[model samples]
Target: MVAPALILVILVTLWPVAQSFYNSLFDYRLTDPSRSERFTQSNIDLERYATEYFYISRDLEDLSAQAPDDETAQAVNDIQTEIEAFHSELIEMDGLEEQYGEVDEMIASFTAISDRDLKYAEVDNDWAEGYKDFLAASNEELIALSEGAPEEDFSTTAGNVAGTLDTINSAVIESNFIGLSNYSRYLQDARMWQSLLNTFIFTIASVAVELVLGLAIAILINRVFIGRGVVRASVLIPWAIPTAVAAMMWGFLYDGQTGIVAHYFEQFGLINDASVLLSTANGGMFSVIFADVWKTTPYMALLLLAGLQTIPGSLYEAAEVDGAGKWQQFWKVTLPLLKSAILVALLFRTLDAFRVFDLIYVLTGGGPANSTESISIYAYITLFSQQNFGAGSVLSVIVFLCVALISTLFIKFIGSDLFEGRSR
Candidate 1:
């Protein structure tokens, strides 16, 4: 029974992370044609190679016949022979001849080779290197010949052939596997470090404020009152709002001009100007933290309220009978019993706060110069906006590590308390 559930957990949780880790090992980017997929060895894009080779072969044959001198004609013929020799070797590779023939036929018929296996073929690393070097040298020679050729048409044709050779060289895709270089690159990236610092600041500040306010609110609601149910329900309204919706609503409230909340803040002297809220780095950070605290404090209060109810009323009564005042009773009885609940609440909130994305994304958009950019937001931009999967995955793995570390520390504290209780 446990095995089945554990297997499910691994499949659902670990599989995606493993896939991301694998992607991080390559220089994967969707925007670049050559690096759109993960390749561990050099390969030829048969579709592009076959099409360009057909035209290049014909052009080279024409150039040799039209050469201005015997030396030029011989150079053209030799370049064509070397290219054909490399091509012959390429098509002879295992399982490539059939695909190459198909691609050639497709090109002749003006049909696209849509199958990936028919469009790309693995080639030996040494062969690819030699082919690329030969093409580069041949292109330079053709360019030099074109510049010195007397006939204008011959000069133009030679330059065009040289351009074709360069294109063919690019068809030889090298391995994109960079191993751990993406991780190392980002380790020195200043933006990555700054974004991480912003994330930590937001998490620590928001969680700390929420904990204090939440505890006070929970204590207030726990006492008997005529409208306690209404009060408790009303307190949850902010948390009940969808985070994106809340963030958008706060966006309006924080607007520099024509915003009621901003006006009130200015009147309260919290800021020198209403526009400063959305236009300055420090102000942007404060705005996000404040909005987060308002939206999440009720959640924190609810969790603590549950823990507060678990404490027997007799304990408080006993403390009072011993002449302990309210503060003394709270410190002696309420706090000690509430340790586990507080830790649990802190764990949940800290993890959630550290991974914050939508709230800050919609609120400040990590702006006023990215003063409030969290690591998650940075990853989202790199992964989606920039289409850089390798670097984005590194950021994602970093977030997972940070969250794991925080959870480990909190669990250790909770576990030690449990062990001590059991021993007692």
Candidate 2:
């Protein structure tokens, strides 16, 4: 019965997470200057190792110059022998890569992909050509070294030669793709953590304001009163507004010179001469939270109202009969009865707050300098803006896990009947 949604959740949520973690290991940025360089970085260590072997081969040439006459030829022979051993080691390393590393394959996969190519490209003919060249060069180097050819015989210098090797290693065409290199690169970046912290601040402040205002309004309307229906309907106006539209409305209101919000706040002495709220960091934060609270509080109120309705009217009557005052009845009876609803409201609002984007975008655009960048916004940036698919995936996967953990914790502590539990 609930299987489809659960399956969909797993597909949409969990599957993406697994994919992101996989990507974070690779340097799979779509827009990086070295789209190929990212792949090179992914295999940096392996490439370095191979180059180290080359350098050692070169150093033996240095040692050859100082050799005594009889042994100089023997030294040449010894260098040849050592070079063969190095080639054997390189082959063993490649075998290990086949069994344990996919640096080359992973790099190829990134280079072979773009907006132009779909997954596992049409013919992969280009990659094949590139692969053949790379392999030939790799084999040529090994052959030359083993043949006791001086390192200077190669077309490129020893230092520059490794870069050519890197180019070959990073040819991660779709067919040859394997390894977790992109994701490892994601962990090394600093901007990701900054965006994460920004998101946390926005979500927490927004949810707190919504919960407090919502509960207050719910209690206000819970009592018997004329025009209560009108009041209740009024409360829903903010919730009824499309989030995008409301975001625009707030954007205008937060405008410095012409905004009514600025005019009124200044008139009331809330600020000295500041005319806009979204320009400053603290102001932008406050504005977004304010807008969020205005839009979502009614939703929180409605959920709490539903819970308020379930409390038998008789419980309040009895509390009054037992000499409990209005505040006493509310504290002793209303709050307890409303626990389930409160939790439900909080869970919904909290999750929504964590994922918030449209409002921040319309209102702040995650600026005056990325101050308001939430995790969701950062994920968007990583995925689309920066085009670092792997890094974006890592951030996205982290968000998924955090949301899942929050939902799970809320259900265990306050929402026991929310996700899976039911009355027997």
Candidate 3:
């Protein structure tokens, strides 16, 4: 039983981390065609090359007609001849002619080329380099020709020639494998460090407040009252709300002009202005922490309340019989007995708060100069928004390390307490 559970845990947790670690060793981005793949050797994206070359050939013929002088027309024709010579040799490689024909047909029909064998072809490293250098020189010369051309049509044709060359240039794939460079670069980045600091501050502050408030509420609701059940259920409503919905709700409440919460805070002098809550650095941090405490405190209370009920009533009776007052009984009997529960509650809340994302994201979007941007939000931007998979995976691995450390510390320091709670 334990073996199956452990295997499942490893598969879910460690497998993704291993994959990310592997990807972080490369320089990969979805936006750049050449560096998009993690290639170990010289390769060609034949689908891209053939399609762009097709356009380049047609554009060069058009450019020769638009040339302002005989000399310029000859120069354009000569460059086209050189490119075609290089391309002819490239297609003559083993099995590439057939692949090129298929790719060109696919391009003509506007079909997506999904076959790897047709899309990419391995080539000699030296030949690939020499070809790329020729294309680069051609591009530079075309740019000069564009600027010096007298006629508007000649200039436009020259500029298009350079751009089409750029598209063809993107077909060459060099090895992007650079192990540990992404990690080293980010370790030196100041913004990354600041985001980590923000995560810690948000986690510590919100969890501390929730612990105190949750304990107080737990103790209050644990007592017998006319509507104790109703009070306990009401207390859980905040925690029951979805995190994203709660964040949007708080966004409105923290708005400057029309928000009741902001207006009251300004009137009470808690803030100098109504708009500052979500618009300033300190204000943004405070708003996120405040909103987190409000939403998660009930969860903490419920955990404590479970532990509180486990303590035997006879212990409190015995303490009272020994002349222990209410305060004395709470300190000597209640607190000592509730230690395990408090530790468990703190561990759970600390881990959850440290990984906070959607709450701060939907509320402030990590704005007001990213004062409230947690490490998770930063990772999300790097991964999806920027499409830099290598750097994004590095950030993700860092978050995983931090979470693992937090878990290790909790288990190392309070393992006995946790075990005791479990036994009870």
TM-score per candidate = 0.94, 0.66, 0.80
Q: Which residue ranges in model 2 land beyond 4 Å of their true spot?
A: 1-9, 32-191, 224-229, 419-424
Candidate 2 vs candidate 3: which has greater lDDT?
3
Q: Write the per-residue lDDT of candidate 3 for residues 290-406, one digit (tens) a residue.
A: 999989898898989998999999998998899999999889988888987898788888999988999999999987898999999999999999999989999999999999999
Please give, for residues 179-204, the per-residue lDDT of candidate 2 as tens digits.
55444654566666666777788778
Better of 2 and 3 by TM-score: 3
lDDT of 3: 0.89
lDDT on C-alpha atoms for all candidate structures: 0.92, 0.65, 0.89
Cα TM-score of candidate 2: 0.66
TM-score: which candidate is best?
Answer: 1
Weakest lDDT window of 10 consecutive positions for candidate 3: 415-424
Best by lDDT: 1
Candidate 1 error regions (>4 Å): 1-12, 416-424
lDDT of 1 by residue, 1-424 (tens): 7899999999998998998888999999999998998899998998889889989989999999999989999999999999999989887888788878888888999998778877888999999999999999999999999999999988999999999999999999989999999999999999899999999999999999999999998998897779877877787899888999999999999998987899999999999999999899998999999999999999999999999999999998898899999999989999999999999899889999999999999999999787889999999999999999988999999999899999899988888764554576
> Which whole-number lDDT from 0 to 100 does residue 165 have in model 3?
90
For model 1, what is the alpha-carbon lDDT of residue 146?
A: 98
TM-score, cand. 3? 0.80
